[model samples]
Target: MAKKKNKKASPNTIGTNKQARRLYEILETFEAGISLLGTEVKSLRGGHVSFKDGYVSFHDGSAFLVGVHIAPYEQTGQYDQHDPERRRRLLLHKHEIDVLQSKVDQRGLTVVPMKMYFSRGKVKVQIGLGRGKNVHSKKQDLKDRDIQRDTQRQLASYK
Candidate 1:
């Protein structure tokens, strides 16, 4: 008989956004394994995930990722469908939780999801603790971004 072929796997870098990076400054980043169902994993692998409206929350000393939607895999069985928008648990260390708790206790900070990537064949979410940006600050940020992009474009032309 021919030898069995083990299924191959690859880690994909699902690029994040400016908000994730901007907040990553004061934001302590902690990687945690996310709980996922079979279809959820398949959908995430198929790039059917979104973190735009997602936010992290702490409950009973455990942090969770909420509002992240991973579409159901179409090839799966029909009866036991997993909820796409259910609250998913984030696996973090005790010390990390303690530190996050203190920072979250402060009025201005909130936890945000940074990136989600596969690690050792399991999906992981990178969460961050950060303070919100005011309207003026957001405007200043846009200005800075435009300036940076212009500088990069100018440099590219000279090359």
Candidate 2:
């Protein structure tokens, strides 16, 4: 008889924007509900979401998530299919929206989607208020990461 491999499953993480941390200095984060279509929610549950090049924008005092791609559900018929890159509304309190609007008005500060995941059976997005990192800062971050990695490796070998 063959032995079964029982692997531990990770907590549900639909997708994350790895590039966001590298490109931006995130100052604060917020968890906001996403207004998703039926098909879109199904696709996200199936782990078909992309945050690459995705950003947040506001209009008429409402926040919108733009550029994030949620692949349509494979089983859904054409008539019920949702657009892959539609602008989805984000549910935030009025005060939160006002704060975000003010921060975005500052020079070089903007909002971006950091992660998408399911929470308590509902799809949610983690958005961040960030400033774009300059070249020197990026280089410094890379150097610090390298140093940390080296120290961890040395400690592990000694142990």
Candidate with maximal lDDT: 2
lDDT of 2 by residue, 23-139 (tens): 999999999999999999888877888888799999999999999999989998889999999999999999999999998996658899998877889888999999999999999
Model 1: per-residue Cα lDDT over 20-103, one tens digit each = 656444447778888788888888777787787788888888978898878888988888678989999888888988788788
Model 1's lDDT to the true fold? 0.77
Instruction: Estimate every model's Cα lDDT from 0 to 1.
Output: 0.77, 0.90
Clashing pairs in 1: none
Per-candidate RMSD, Å: 6.3, 2.5
| TM-score of each candidate structure, all chains considered together | 0.81, 0.91
